[model samples]
Target: MPSLGSFVLTCIIIAISLVLSVSASVGNIKSGPSPRRFMSGSQRHNATFSLTQIRNTKWEPREMSTTAVYAAEFLKHKVQMPKVLRLAWEKLKLHDDQSSNSSIHRRVDGQLVRYSDGQYVFPVTIGTPKQTLNLIFDTASGDFWVWSWLMPMDMLQNRKYYNGSASSDATPWDGQSWGATYAVGSNYGIVWQDIVWIDAIGVAGNPIECSQGVSNWFASLPGVDGVLGLSYAYNDSEKPEPQQTWITYILPLLAAPVFTVSLVHNGIGTIDFGFIDQKKYTGSIVYTPITIIPGGGAFWAFNWTGFAIGSDKYNRTNIQVMTDTGGNISMMPESIANRYYKLVAGSYKQANGAWIFPCKASLPNFVFGVGSSRIVVAGKNFILTNLPDGINCIGGIQSREEDTYVFLSIPFMQSIFVVHDYGKMRMGFANRTWV
Candidate 1:
């Protein structure tokens, strides 16, 4: 048997290759959830969509379970989304000790959704009263911050909501007094108060207590009230580190040698605690040094090799790829997409809703390049070949989309065993069974 260390190292190598070797292509239509089991070779599924009317959507507070323990099973199977990228859990241990890490859980539509929103919410929290918060967890960014959405409005009058606003147990970023600020994104607009204070963030039930640098941006979305930022660094670098981010405060506290995440298909993934899972990995952990995007805080990134339509490679080069939980679709270059459609003898078509195409009975494989490496990956279905012209170009396809197709949403994360410990500053991956 391999030594424990050797076994873990081997697993990391396999995990990295598995992720990087996924082929880029489109596939045939299907009508079901994504496959929850892993396969030796690439597979593809077609994606379809229909807009659902938002009806009877209302908010009700679900009591946080008093029990701390929960049952967990190993995960398997995988799916992909084209235009939407498969996202990984952006993690930061606030205090560093094993016990300091909070189980990250998500409240989807209020119930213990177990899984966080794929691209909608962050499993993080902020404030002195320990106000629970979530964010668009972006691996490319490193700043830890929060926003206010669907706040009771009356809570604003409670004064406790503004713990950082009053500078009571709270501190300010760069001596700046608490005040309201505004910003915008691809989605909604935001207006918030900038404040600083300790944050108690939780994931899957694990909690971490630490100081944070945050924004009080507020919106009107229920179930999702605020963002939980996880950028490499904050917008203001001069601010004290604690006042800057929770990740920064936790990086130095880890006892583990490295970390990793498996954004598998289905709601069946795990974040390794002390080390990578040896049973699921194959070789040494592949380490690639990455340069953060100009505005990205410290999200890790790598280069993509090529994409293909069916067996023929699209032949585009120099594409960049990053695993992002903030993005909901697999995205890529439009030129590459055009080439893919041409190969399949399929043309992009505009639908009554989101434009779609005639998904061939045969699925085309898509590959993503990472730092001169390429990995073969599958798609939810063949129907949604690529994004519409105005939509973002995605070589980065999400696995699950419609019923039969696998979505690259948080559910896919359950497919792979993962860990992202800050202390090690390294990522690990493992192949787990969805069964």
Candidate 2:
């Protein structure tokens, strides 16, 4: 009924109106409070997930024409239009996904309760019906594994095992196997896929390895059923076929590619995914670039500039250090460890391989540098516990082979709030506020 040009104009107007309407809807949804559903009964009490805002403001700007005057004007005004549009698009997509109740761009907080053995364990639910298990959230490992029904009955006594048959979403991955050898022990098992839930955030089709057998060291772990590794996906121990880490699969569903760990002594710690709690730490977060270990190890390795014991400062160059939540003691190079102990009078290495000192000895103040920031670990924190006789006390910092890398364990972690930035391959640390 209308001319070609008029009809074309009409279609264009309709298309633009539709796009604007959809965009306005998305903006409204993102600005409003998202609907939350809770699991009825005790399950609801065990897990409480909430979204937190991301603190980092860094953004990547889109490339623009060098000759464009408007581009220069945008830069002069400190407004990156391309980046802003990209962020808006991301928000729109995230809102659509959240509305579908399939995925969410929200920060998730998981409770970490300290165990008697000085290790912290967190809860992770697996499968369709949701079987919850307390797992050691190890930052050094790259595999998400659990003790399974496939193991011997005696070995499974008092230990929870994943019953794959009971999970409707469980899918077997035949021929895929994974094995990991830790300083404590080893575990081996078959790889499978299922829904893995941390707090209330569910990652469907999550790759998980169910351990068929474990060494005595692993079996002896108190109140731990398995490990949920937080290391990069490339470090997965699945031989012949390596799969992505659990975090990798869930990253897309998060608002930010960051996770924060706050460890408290003999108390409940917390792991925040997608955001950092500014209130948990003091001062600005100092970020240090990750040092990739030769041969590609999965540890959260970083550079250590130097260390100080009281007024004495020891400078180092290119020293690579790592943090592991699974380890209880901080292990440093033998020479450095000796030097540190020397600063504390009466501290000596015993025949039992422990470095012990008088329980009442005044320990030297210790601090370590990462980049431009210095993290001070109070000398009192280095004293783990006194002997039963209450004379000699065990030191938190111990000596390892000179070739062995330095490992910052629970003692060091407890004093700082750490951020593991997978997207940037950097580690950020800030002093934790003792409550």
Candidate 3:
């Protein structure tokens, strides 16, 4: 008979294999909620009319839930038990030797919702009385900004704006003028410091950019109030003195120096601060070193080994992979994009610079390697649905000519659980339970 430890290890290996097999089989089946419906006639009309007309229209708050589902797959499968047991034993020995030095860590979690525009927004409260606002939890950019009272009335149309005067906790951060430009639009604003709350935890004197004016693209998205940046401090675009990201200020308060995100398609996922929820993922979490950009850590990027589609594998000499929740589709090098689309029948590049194909065209599972681990994104996640008329659908993987970095956007992120480790300067990925 095998030793108890050996038997346990064998069982764990079998369980992990079964879980992976089941996940691979389920990839063929369509799951999760359908894509969001197109904008209403009234919304479309508002888009065409003047900003004043849209501001006059009363905007009712849509029912968006931020409750996350607890995944039971990990408990049922007993995946990663061997590693868990080893870690628990080590911790137990430490506790027995020095109980006073050991400290209990507290984890804070917030619910995240996938907006119609494919961005993940989480609930944030600012001010003394605590006014809750749905802000985009973006890791790509490092600027915490919100729609404020200073903005033009036309710009405030149908969106909630933070009124600093109404909150006793609000304090002006000098007369600082701040401006930031994203792929969407440019926004210039005044800076303010106030009590900001994420779930039950609150951060005092949190820096917030209150926008006074914005570009046309910013005006179009009336649903999103502002952005809560989670990137490093160096990525912050604030002029003169750079401000640290919310994660930086809140790290001391957390039990762990880590944050994890689980983004599911059309369903409520979660952002856990200071700890990783083993329940949300299966198997072991693969950790990859964070690649530093030229100037600084602009985004959570890592060195990508290569990408594989079915039997064909493409190796790259130098590749930087960055994950962004703010973006909808993945962007790769032009050559890679062309090669990927060629694999699908009837897929061709459009004059408008988009790769289009038959809506029903079958695509191979997109797999990318990081370190020694492979992360697989299902084919269903690669099809961008609800395009403008005539264009059936476009490939989710688009081509970018400028940057050497390949962007893994929300479409790819929705398939896995991502961990952003600040202390270790590493990013981790695991197979999501649902996928």
Which one wins on lDDT?
2
TM-score versus the correct structure, for each prediction: 0.48, 0.70, 0.70
| Candidate with more favorable, higher TM-score: 1 or 3 | 3
Q: Tell me how far the alpha carbon of residue 2 in candidate 2 is from the true structure, in angstroms, after superposition.
A: 87
Across 1-435, the per-residue lDDT of candidate 2 in tens digits comes to 000110011110111111000000111111111122222332322232332211111211111111111111111112222343334334434553455331121111111111134133566788879897766666765667788887889998876778887998777665566765432125677766777777556765666777777745356554456767678666566656666677765665566788887766545577787777788899989999888767545668898788877778557555778776655456677787888899888987543245778878887766788777787776766665554445766676766557655767666777788999988989998876653
Q: What is the C-alpha lDDT of each candidate?
A: 0.29, 0.57, 0.56
Prediction-by-prediction clash tally: 118, 0, 0
Better of 1 and 2 by TM-score: 2
| Model 1 accuracy (lDDT, Cα) | 0.29
Q: Which stretches of candidate 3 lie over 4 Å from their true place?
A: 1-115, 118-120, 182-185, 314-318
Those runs of model 2 whose alpha carbons end farther than 4 Å from true positions after fitting are 1-115, 182-185, 314-318, 386-389, 401-404
Model 2 vs. true fold: TM: 0.70
Could you tell me which 10 consecutive residues in candidate 3 have the lowest summed lDDT? Answer: 1-10
